[model samples]
Target: MDTTKKLPLEMVYHWESSSPDSLYMTQPIGHGKVVEYTWGRAVNEARRMAAYLKSLNLPEKSRIGLISKNCAHWIMTDWAIWMAGHVSVPLYPTLNADTVNYILNHAECDVLFVGKLDDWDMMKPGVPESVRCISYPLSPSNNFETWDDIVAKYPPLEGRVERDPDEMATIVYTSGSTGRPKGVMLSFNNMAFAAAGGIETLGVGPSERMLSYLPLAHVFERTFVELGSLYSGFQLYFAESLDTFVQDLQRARPTLFLSVPRLWVKFQHGVLQKLPKEKLERLLKIPVLNKVIKKKVLKGLGLDKVKLAGSGSAPLSNDVLDWYRNLGLELLEGYGMSENFAYSHMNKPGRTRTGYVGESLPGVETKISEQGEVLVKSPASMMGYYKDDEKSREAFTEDGFLKTGDKGEIDEMGRLKLTGRIKEIFKTSKGKYIAPAPIENKLMSHAAIEMVCVSGANQTQPHALVVLGEEIRPKAADEAFRKELEESFKSLIKDINKTVDPHEQLAFITVVSDEWSIENSFLTPTLKLKRNVVEDAYQARVDSWYAKKQPVIWQ
Candidate 1:
């Protein structure tokens, strides 16, 4: 991988000119149909869009907002934004109107590109009348200037717009798991360095295939799927919808796959539903049967040909990691935040530590602060938080390392295991501190539980608020099911308490009926629990339940 490519567009042009007829990406349109694009065609379409954007004659470095789910058009729009010398501002498709308004206004966006939206009517109220609007492929309605009309009206862009290496390229907003989103300003050099380092570190090449289903608005997906494709010249595939995900995965057969821990857990649960745990264990003990079981499982999951698999965006349970490994799949866990362009750390291919996020990547530096916060310095680090000097200044240490707020420790081999967020650690009346994440991870392993939150704050002992899994939800009303769930949870809690310190042991478990979702403001777009929101919703109930002195409380 050549690090000399100064910009992402340069890499696009390289592939386009060198292998114009090679397949670049395929987008599922629906009804068992997919539209494929070659490198030359993709670049040409992007250039056409860039020509239209240039015709607008907007001010230099003007902010352009892109709101959509993952698709081929999303990448085209992003490339067009940079090609026209504008800064791209991406919004999650799941964002509410208020957040959309806030981010668009805060970013001072002059134009908005809408594509493949779930609810455009709900989002339209947030777009200012002054901001120009454009519609892209697969748009539900022709309410805005259509992408086809613009391309037909304008010629291809004459040449690449000149940009300084340090010039702002994009402003990616954080997923606000803790609070309101803040825009993280990334420069051309930031992305250039990250793309180069990632390609070299992961050993991705032109022949590698990737499926893009994760929200492209998030830096994790953007860095690995979008930027990785450009730098490595890999073929990219897009999932049409959740209903067709399995079919899409089977079609793509991605060589490099990345997913969050939640999805990985869901996959494990899906497999367990087909093959009971005891049966799986017994088969693994037989040498010949283990290979048959492994091959069948991988093929069913559409991961039979996957060369590398990774989980990030949240901590993965070591149990989940080991389960996949038993099936001959090594699921590497990585660690990074939006502030650093997700360039901090990753588990290398051959050297993986089950529970730990791997060592710092090349061109990156990591250290533990006196307060145990993970600090990172890398060429890919964001320039600053856009339009917020005070917050940006507070984000970094005096020596310029980004303060990653996550509490963690590095082992002798330099693998880092995060304990929890500094603000998330709570203290009990016994005056002992407890990290909720590890405890929550343990509780989530129970087959009946889908999500768990541990809180004690001002109480004598911490208790958990859990949401029942989908498989167990309908059975909750049956007497036998209820009795079984109670026993399972009780046994799970007792087993967890034996392994943890006294202060960290959960006192009781309160099972809730309501499902937690992004629409309900309980989870972020990335599917991470909004801890503050969860605590606020259940803290009082937790206090009341703790006073009852029952081992299990069902709501």
Candidate 2:
């Protein structure tokens, strides 16, 4: 298939002239305040920063590290990096010092841009003193040369800078659900093709307003949201913080929204907290009242204006998808990984299946490997893992289709249903191998259960560890609620086991005392469970727990 060399930088030049005064970005600056960046203003600032970046005299295509949460400057810095002919390497804002240090040194970054973050103090020590640091307006107190100073000192670059499509644009490190993250190299054409194709397929245009709360470091946000904006000239809004998400989202009133299953579940629980599930379901049976209640609920959650919505990064329970759909929201599930720039597959507006992640997008090919792994070929495929030839070589088949590492089944109509990760399958002592993802998803459907990880490798039968929902945990302290919750877990398990084969039945479920998070090294930045870490953490007590408890073991 033939593809254009049109790059995001070129798109910026287009918007600079075509719609110079359009609202390009809306960034929250705390204290109920916001700052707007018009297309002209964004381009002008990016060019000025490009001028400053050029002054640094770094080698051509040098890797510059960008560490920040989603913000206006984060996107601007990325554009500036391209305009200055450098490669950007963005680190997750929540990364530990060691990981931050490893990526910086591994990428051989000559400069680093420190943007808005909550853990700058912890991450700063990881940054090498040799690398030049540039601080953003919202950055923590640092002595580095400031972004404001650079914009004031240097004039915007003389002319619209153009980029060669094949040049390395950025090095995106995987979230590392299992091991150390690998830097995935993407070219200008790689990002441009992805942004352009997704825009055309999804019918995104200048009128589309999207909220950019997801980390731009990941391919999903960068390709779909950041670069998508450059391609479609959409108005992008930045969410300030987790505490003010509802208010911030309300302000943006995004026409399209994308979120993870975890957040979506939280939203469901948030709704259920105010109106019990039984009551809400009963009210929905009454036609007019149902519509009114749905509107009120969505408006309360700042999602009433969303014309299109998506859940990705992990598999969302069908129950939650149905819940949002019941509220008259068009929530679709998409399937893609960081390696493919998240352009692999997505459900269309009218052609959606409940559990399936949708058919392959136009200009994409998919096939099942002999081992049952999902393989894909897309125009937006990455250049391969940066500086890791062995791993890169192993990532694809001889025919060049990327080994997605996910096990899935494609229906006759071309829809894809992900079963589990090929690597996540574990064996029991009885010689039966079990896939935990599908089982974990069953328990995840219950509102009282927040996160579930099914484990028990080399044991008689596999079991699961679950963290109670935020609201459910406190209520569990009451003896009455505790008994009621245990009975429900028993029923949930019994129901789930009836669906799976006998060997795959869960032995018991342990209620984990603590929650998994990036900070705790139990979950990846994308919220995928670190299976190995989790298994190791609970290994010692595995035998003892089964002996003491009947079915639902409390940690």
- lDDT of each structure? 0.89, 0.89
Model 2 spans with C-alpha error above 4 angstroms: 1-5
User: What is the TM-score of each predicted model, taking all chains together?
Assistant: 0.98, 0.98
Candidate 2 local lDDT, 91-137, one digit each (tens)? 99899999999999999999999999998988888999899999999
Query: Per-prediction count of colliding residue pairs?
Result: 0, 0
How does residue 259 of candidate 2 score in lDDT? 93
Determine which window of 10 residues in candidate 1 has minimal summed lDDT.
1-10
Runs of candidate 1 exceeding 4 Å displacement = none
TM-score of 2: 0.98
